[model samples]
Target chain A: MLKIKNLFLKKDNFILGKISFEIEKNSYCVILGKTGSGKTMLLESIAGIQNPEGNLYFDGKDISNISPNKRDFGFVYQDFALFPNMSVEKNIKFSARYKKIEDEKNLFLDLIEFLQIKDILKRDIKYLSGGEKQRVAIARAIYSRPKLLLLDEPLSAVDPTFRNSIMKSLKEIVQRYNTTIIHVTHNFREASYLADKIAVMLDGQILQIGDAKDVLNSPSSIEVAKFLGFKNIFSTKILGFEQKNKFFSIDPNKIDFLKEKCLDDYCFECKIEKIMGITDHYKIFATVKDTQSFFAKIPKQIFMELKLNEGDKSYIFINKKDVVFI
Target chain B: MKDKSFLIVFLFLGSIIVLFLMVPIMNLFYSVGVNNIFETLQDKETYESIFLTLKSSFFAVLFVCFTGIPLAYLIARYNFWGKSILESLLDIPVMVPHTAAGIALLISFNHGYIGDFLSFIGLEFIDTTIGIISAMMFLSAPFLINGAKEGFKKVDIKYEHVAQTLGASKLSVFLSISLPNAKNDILNGALMMWSRGLGEFGAVVIIAYHPMVAPVLIYDKFNNFGLKFSAPVAASMILVSICLFLSIRYINNKV
Candidate 1:
């Protein structure tokens, strides 16, 4: 288990303010955040690479001021900072040598096969392709069987096509090693697929940290909603209770009742400014209050059936209970 | 000149500079023929001075390897207080006049607290081999430190962190990751410092002139008997230096 209490770090002019969170042992935790959100900095601090001014309890020990070598945390960089001077075999051997485990060789072989990196073991690091390098990095990190595997945007440098395969490989590796992981990334898709817990970090502070579904379906604030790629959002007060999208089916009974008074509830009143779509899908861009814009995606059939056009007034209702007020 | 003939201008300027450098060495060889160089090499004093020069410079670089490498690594990796000042201090030997550096080293080694401490240990600097090595080190250390520092800077700190996380100790990470990665740069720096130490006359002459290095001997011979007597010794020294330099370059490039 890893517990960070009121972690504070001041790097250059950016301050990672009083961030606090925890992850259970052998669980997959993804600190989901945008770039420059101090995600990498926080990881370094936990890995003991950076001296953080806060309490870091790992497996019931206070490791706030310990050095990185003693932390026994496996950290993978985005660039895969593999030892270029050492060939693949040497790199893995160099790391595994420290374990001096009786079964290190067997364990290494298992990881190589599981991560699908056995083919590149004899090649120099420079000779390996980008995806190959990524696998090698992951394999090397697991070679020592680190207590907590901390990956900083591990797939950011790999080919986009290889991302899905690598994610599956990560799950297999985690299960095999039973290692606690804190994977930092900015993509929700990755979080949804990999994380047992998702921590939404924005502007240097974790705004919300919960189950992946909880954080995604109900983001705490507008900033987080936007970060999660949410559009067509108006004030909870202006949107009545209904998790409705312009796309797909709309309940006629609910639509008629949504047109009724929902003053105290969250409902959005807007004028359609423009419509954009081809084929079955349509995007309705609308003006809410003077300058604020809200966009929704609906089916082209719905647009034609309703005879919707520019300047048409519309309303998107959000159920009061579902309206997340931050 | 037009851009089309830029190569002509570049080649012409490069040839002039190359010729300017080679002409003097060529003149030295012509002045002292191979027979004269062999005759100078046969002289015990000429051989001994050249040997002493190589020996002192070698020890000086050895000392640089021990002290300078760690200091360079620290400067490259950490941001402690006075880091910028310490970095600037490493360049002091290169920036100051060689004679001024000799004078500064002289007082520090010959008198005061440090000099007394050394003497207490029976390591006097005045007219001693230790003095020659110390003077050479003082004049040439910047080359090693600056070179190693540049190499260390180019090595990403991420590798060090990864190595540490892989259950390697700090020293082990440095040896296994940082040192090997920066080996070429550090060796280049060591070579530069070694060559610079070979040519150090101003500092070594003041501290220990009795056990003369090659450059000091050449200067002394020129003062006593003019160019004719010293040219052969100078030519031999240059030949020996060029041979060692080429051999090192060959090994370095091969590696």
Candidate 2:
């Protein structure tokens, strides 16, 4: 396990605010944030590339003063960061040599085979494609068998199709090595797919931390909810609780779509504004009472059967359990 | 179709500039026949001057490479107090006239302060080969440093970080990655510095008048003997510089 406590790193005019977190052994933690939210800085601190003004511990040992080479953590940067002067095989072997490992050639060959870069072993780094370079970088990082892995936007620079395959490969590598990973990204889909726990950061502060689904489904604040694509969030007074403070909440994905009118207390009439066909479902947008707009996803077959169109009027029955108050 | 008038105007101006630059050197070569060139090659003074110039300039380039590369890397990679000041200071040698550079060297190395202290310890700079190397180094080292720094800056720092994470020490990363990657710029800088050192006249004349380099020897020959006596040596130096410059360009292409 790795633990970071009360870390405050100041660089120029930007300050990475006091932050703390722990990564359990063999677990994948994804840090989600927008651009310039100090996600990279935090990861660099953990990797010992950027020294923070606090303590860091690995397996209950204090590592705050350890040098980057002594940290024993594999760090993969966004740009792959392969040495341009070395060939593919030499690049992978450099770290293994530094760690003074026996049977270095066999280990390097194993990694090259695992990453499927065997044919390019003799090729210079300048000749490798983007995906190949990233694979080489990953192979080099894991060559020393580091205790933890830190990846900063590993798939952000690749094509969308390549992103899926690379992420899957990375997940398999982490699992096979039983290495704890702290991955950072701004893409919600990657976070939802890879993270065992998610930490949402904004303006240098971690705004929320919880399970990925919990953070996505019920954010702690209107800003986080909006950032997570909660479309129907509102700041309003409860109908019967006049003395209570004004609260903000969102309609969850459990809200049901209605084809015809029904006598229900938890139903609201709405006009269909837009309909979008997604991979497995259709996203339906409706404006309720001309004041609130909500989005819902239904099965594509049901959507085709109903044949919903724009400007159509309908009622959406939102379950009370589906409404989250923040 | 191209406009005949504009084409004529451009070609006319270009020809004039090219002639203005090449005529003096061409006149030197024309003045020295093939027989005179062969005869001058056997002259002991001519060989000594050429050898001294090449030797001193080579040493000056070596010194610049030793000191300038690390300074460039530091400026390119790190942020520290007075970084901008240090960057501007690097241009000081380039902007100052070589005559003034020579005068500054004379004052610092003369028997007043540093010169006296150094002499007490057994090192001398006045009228020595070391003085010639120093003068050439002062006026030309900045070109090397600035060029190499720009090259290193273009390389991604993540490469070094990756090397570090791979277990390579800091020095190993520099040797294995940074030096090889910046080889082109380093070579270019060395070429510029060496060529500049060879052509340096004012500073070397002030610091070391005896054991003359090619530029100072050319000036001495012209003043004492005549243009006719200096023409062969000047042509020889120009020919050698052209060959060196072309080789540098070729290497740059390969890199």
Candidate 3:
């Protein structure tokens, strides 16, 4: 397990303002954030590339004062900084030798076979493609058998078409090595696919942390919800409620379009304001009697069956189970 | 059409400069003639002076390489408090007049502190081959250091960091990665130092006029027997330097 507690780092104008998290062993934790949100700085601090002014423990051992090379963590930079003078095989062998591991040749061969870059072992680094270079860099990083792996925007440099395959390869390698990885990215799809637990970061602070679906479905704060593209959130007050909860949360997908529903505990009359077709689904926008506006995404076939149009009156239903109070 | 116009201008400028540079050297060869060149080569004194010039210059270049490469790498890689001051100090020898350089060396290595100490160890720098080599090194060492520093600066420091991460020691990285990358620049610096050493006259004449290098020999011959007697040796030295320069240029191109 990797634990960072009250980690504070101040350099120039950028600050990692009081970060704390625990990454369980062999779990893939993806940090999601916009640019200049301290995602890369946090990863660097974890890797021990730069010292932070707080406590960091790896598997219950303090590594706050450890040098980067001594931290036993593998780091993949965003640029895939391969040594230009060395061949692919030599580049992979460099870190292996640095860690003083025996059987370096066998390790090199294994990595080359795993990455499927055996054919280009003798080729110089400048000749490799983006994907190929990234594979070599990953191979070099993992060859030392580091306990922790840090990836700083690995797929951000590649083309969109190659991103999925590269990410899949990286995931497979990390699993095969049983390496605990802290992957950082700005892309939502990458975060959703890779993260067992997601930490949403903004402006040098982590706004929320939970399971990927949980964070996306119900964010902890307004800024986090908006950062995650939750478009229909509003400051609402409870009205005519027997259960005296302060607030309620609902997934737009779970809200049903009906006049009379027996299963739903909450119902409201709304007028359809706008309809938008979003690939394979329809996003319905509606206003609930001068209270607040909401959006519901439903499948295209189901939306066609309803034959809903703009300015049409409708009933929106929300089940109590779908409504989470936080 | 645009390329043709550029080509015409380039050729015109090139030919004018080439003619201006070659005419004086060609005049020496024309004066020596084919028969006189062979006759001059047959002389024992000509061979002796040529051999002395080559040997002393070779030693001077060797000394420059040993000291200059590391100093240049240090200046290029590290930022210290007095780095720019040290760099300017190195340029002082190159920019100062060679006659003043020889006078400075003479005063320092002449009598008391270092000179007498060295003389007690049977190494004197007065009217000896050592004096000639010392003079040449003083005038030429700056070329090697400046060239090598520029070369080292152009190499990416990330390569060294990567090597360090890979498990190589600092010395191993310098030898395998940095040295090989800077090979061309080192060779160029050596060639510059060697050429400068060969053409040294002002300092060599002031310090060691007895062990006559080719330049000093030519000067001596011109002073005693006029231009007619010195033309053959001058032409021979010019031809040798031109060939060496061209070969170095070719090697640089190949790299």
- Model 1 per-residue lDDT at B120: 97
Model 2 RMSD, rounded to 1 decimal: 3.5
Selected candidate, larger DockQ, 2 vs 3: 2
Question: Best by DockQ, which number?
Answer: 2
Which candidate, 2 or 3, would have the higher TM-score against the true structure? Answer: 2
Query: What are the per-residue Cα lDDT tens digits for candidate 3 across A1-326?
Result: 89899999998898896999898998888999998899988987887666788899998999998766677787777887787667888877777555676566677778888888999989989888888888888898888777888888888888789888877877786678878888998889998988888999999999888788898777787777667766555444533555533444567788778745344477788899999999999988888876688889888988888888998888888776777544
List, residue by residue over A41-110, the lDDT tens digit for candidate 2: 9988887888889999999999999888888899888888888778888887777657776566676777
What DockQ class does candidate 1 belong to?
Answer: medium
Candidate 1, position A263, lDDT? 60
lDDT of 1 by residue, A1-326 (tens): 79999999998999996988889988899999999999999999889887778899998999988888777789999898899889998887776656664478798878788877778888989888889988888888877778899999998888999999999888766678878889999988889999999999988999999998888777777677778876555543334335533122222112211233366544657677987876777776666675657556666666666677788777655454543444
* Model 1 misplacement above 4 A: A239-270, A288-293, A313-326, B1-4
lDDT of 2 by residue, B1-255 (tens): 379988999999999999999998787777797677767767899878887998999999998888999999999898899999999998999999898999999899876979899788877777899999999999999989988998888878878777777787888888888888888888888888888999999899999988889999899999999988888888777877787789879977886
- Model 3, B124-228: lDDT tens digits are 888899999999999999898998998888777656654544445677778867877787888888888899999999888888998788998999999999999
How well does candidate 2 score on lDDT at residue A24? 88
